[model samples]
Target: MWATGLGSGVRALTTTRFGGHSRPPFDSLNLGIHVGDDPAAVQSNRLSLAGVLPANPVWLNQVHGVDVLQADRVQSDQEPVTADAAVTTRTRQVLAILTADCMPVVLADTRNRILGVAHAGWRGLARGVLAHTVQEMAMRTDGQSRIHAWIGPGIGPDAFQIGPEVRETFLEIDGRLEKFFRRDSSQQGKWLADLPGIARWQLLQLGACDVQWCGLCTMGDPDNRFFSYRRDGQTGRIATLAWIET
Candidate 1:
């Protein structure tokens, strides 16, 4: 399910499970450092990835909240920060996020002036991670710059069931969020959530020119590509990366 494209000076790739050396639960190609995979193994896997890509990816301690990071300066954490996004203007410095079910979004301007990536789960989406990322990108671009966003493979709407708390979040943001919810078949209080729709809505709100989505359902498809947390409890992570290669 990994894909790549080149436009202006930007080059990007979203990695699937075809490439690493992690074990069964972690599988092969596990890029997450926080997962139970051995530190040495994780390091080796990442180093292996570096050989194919342009630069070292900027890994984040994603906490499903609204904080966003700048890739030029990243730190080792005593505790994971409450951030779900990262942006950068530097060339060959990759900004990446690890995700299982959560949406991993990559954005780049046509001028290659800036690039950003975000891990937007329900919590971070409700809190405005996309909006914040666009704002951060704006600081580097002129007012005329427009963001081109691509929505990578994620848990599709049919598989993402949520409770009333999610409904409450949409209501809190705007009463119109109810339109995205529909009753789940197996559960009474739970409704199938539309994560991709919500993410597209957020990106539109941010004035992105082109929004591309893979439309691949990670949860529904268990082939050799993605890692779905909701489907596989003790699972590995896949990465979506963005950077300016020019």
Candidate 2:
């Protein structure tokens, strides 16, 4: 459990690939059920994770899109809600987003009564997932003075290479986005994109100036402790979750 010390009343964590019943490839602590990992292993891992939390995590059937939902609106835990993000002002509602190489962004107002978590893949980011999540949080937080965001691990800029179309998507959002992508000299027609840099730029535009990053890269480490879909084609996912304390 990697904690994000956002402040007094909020708790956030990004799980590691170690500590569960899964086998190689999806080896131990694999929390994603949609991936090829065994359902039993995934459930067992979730159950183990539950023992440490105030309540069961409100998981989403993330579609790599920008849809954001309120945790209180989730009708059933058994139903997989097809949204990429979840936010709540209610305490103890463990809002979670699963990620392997994609970024897991967690947000909380300075008051710590409202919290949000988002799964931001390149598609989601290009489509404004972070911006949408920040808007929802600000709506709930109305007059709050600050919105703090913690950006969890993902494939770093040095490891993420993309084609022209991907760069165009971001440029469509903002022409200045070109600064976040650098030409990969070795790979023609490819550029190394900065997922975290793009996220920080979006958050800052939305007035979330206190953005914090857990500098560890999922694909950079050779230990395989942090799950990386780009590194291992068929791999497990780590959950980066946030909940307000009662």
Q: Which run of 10 residues does model 1 get worst, by summed lDDT?
A: 74-83
Spell out the clash pairs found in candidate 2: none
- The TM-score values for the models, in the order shown, are 0.91, 0.95
lDDT of 1 at 166: 81
Tens digits of per-residue lDDT, candidate 1, 1-246, equal 444433567777778876778888887888888878887877778888766677667777888877888766764322344468988887787778898889899888776478888998888888889999888888887677767888888899888988888888888997777777899989888898888988887788778877877787778865748888888888888888877878
Model 1 lDDT, residue 29, Cα = 84
TM-score quality measure for candidate 1: 0.91
* Candidate 2 per-residue C-alpha lDDT over 63-166 given as tens digits, one digit per residue, 9 for 90 to 100: 99988987887643667788999889877888888999999998888664778889998999988898888878877754664778899989888999899999
RMSD of each: 2.5, 1.5
- In model 1, the runs with Cα more than 4 Å from the true position are 1-6, 74-82, 222-224
Could you tell me the lDDT of residue 91 within candidate 1?
76
